[model samples]
Target: MSDTAATSSRRLPPANGATLGAMFVAGAVATMAFDLWGQILSPGLGWATLSPHGLARSLLGRFGLPNGDFAGYFVHFYLVGLLGYPLGWLLVFRPAWRAVIGAGGPWILPAALYGLALWVFAIGGITAIAGLPFFLDFTGITWVALIGHVLYGIVLVAVLRRFRLG
Candidate 1:
């Protein structure tokens, strides 16, 4: 096979039990890190607090569903953090990144950029869906959220690397 073909074929590590477990662990830990930044650290530092539950509730309310704290937490923790974001990282972003960048360098910059993209998706898309202004009108909260998300992405990649999964 040509070098390009070989590179493409091996771009992603095989997905198996260990890999999936690592992704789950990375996702959960990263989510916890984001929650800490939003709920504790940022607030203690006089920054805006992030209420992901409220966002979840709002989205649920829009759909005329039960918008309880439990529901919100479920969406935030189980759905998005544990499943969605990790899957996006492993199955989507990593592949595209390897394809474009040839998978031979550090992942920090790409991880940060991925986090930034997620921030946009959250601020731009999720907020609008939850009936908030676009990007929260770029308020202080928006910038704080940016930092939280970047922290999340970094943590995610770091943990994955720890497992040799990245």
Candidate 2:
């Protein structure tokens, strides 16, 4: 067989339940940590808004739902699990994708990329919908969010790697 045929014939593995679970759990943990980090610093800095929790609250209020920390928590968990599942599956089971991710040397590098992607989406998509500012202000909250996202990615990848999940 030709090299092209050989390469094309390679099949990717399907993600098992455990791998998916790991991804969701990792995402939850990371998001929780990120939120906690924001909460910790929010008191000191005036007008400092940390994380997407505020956005979630705003969205819930607009929708006439009971808007508060509960809304934020619900939305946060929803997004984390929703996004994490597919990302973990692709990172683990897709050969071409796996190769690209692995090429980054340390797993954290790819995880950082993932975090950046999430931040961009959250800032651009979620914040816009929630009527929140989207990376427009250079504030302490913004800086903390950036760092938090990076940490989220690092932790997510580390957890996945540790469990050999994806």
Candidate 3:
């Protein structure tokens, strides 16, 4: 193939029904893995449980919304997990990385870095928005959240790869 055609092929695939569906499923499964880590595995290992739903609830309350358990779950799971993060991965990060590196390298490192970015966004941005201290004052919960988010990223990438979508 011509160099131009090869370069174009290296670009991220356009968003379509199959791609979007795969992203959705991958995001959902990855989110579930994150929740499991936060709610079960970490606690089982004697770490503090990371309560993203509670953070979502607090943000809702700050905005004078109905900040109930269901509302929190909706915001955390539906809006952020199943929609926002996945789209950010497929639409933003993947494309930008491809543009930079020509999409020739392994995705693992990028996925891990993306997870680290997500950790910062969560611990730095989300917690602050929820009226919590930045990075929870770098407490045990902070590390726990970091691991959870990295796991989330890895799982999301793995699922996408499984579907041959990412």
Off by over 4 Å in 3: 1-10
Put down candidate 2 lDDT per residue, 1-166, tens digits, no spaces: 9987575444232357875676677777776667666666554555455756667788778778888897776776666534543374345433454555443456665677767766666665667677766663555666676767777777776776666643
Question: Measured by TM-score, how close is model 2 to the native structure?
Answer: 0.70
Q: Model-by-model lDDT, in order? A: 0.87, 0.63, 0.87
TM-score per prediction, in order, is: 0.91, 0.70, 0.90
Q: Write one digit per residue (lDDT tens) for candidate 1, span 25-83.
A: 99999999999999999999998999877888888998899999999999988888888
How far is 152's C-alpha from truth in model 2 (Å)? 0.4
| lDDT of each residue in 1-166, candidate 3, tens digit only | 9998786655665658888888889999999999999999999999999899898999999889999999999999999898898887877787788888766788788888788899999899978987889999999999999998998888998899888866
Question: Which residue runs does candidate 2 get wrong by more than 4 Å?
Answer: 1-13, 41-51, 61-68, 81-104
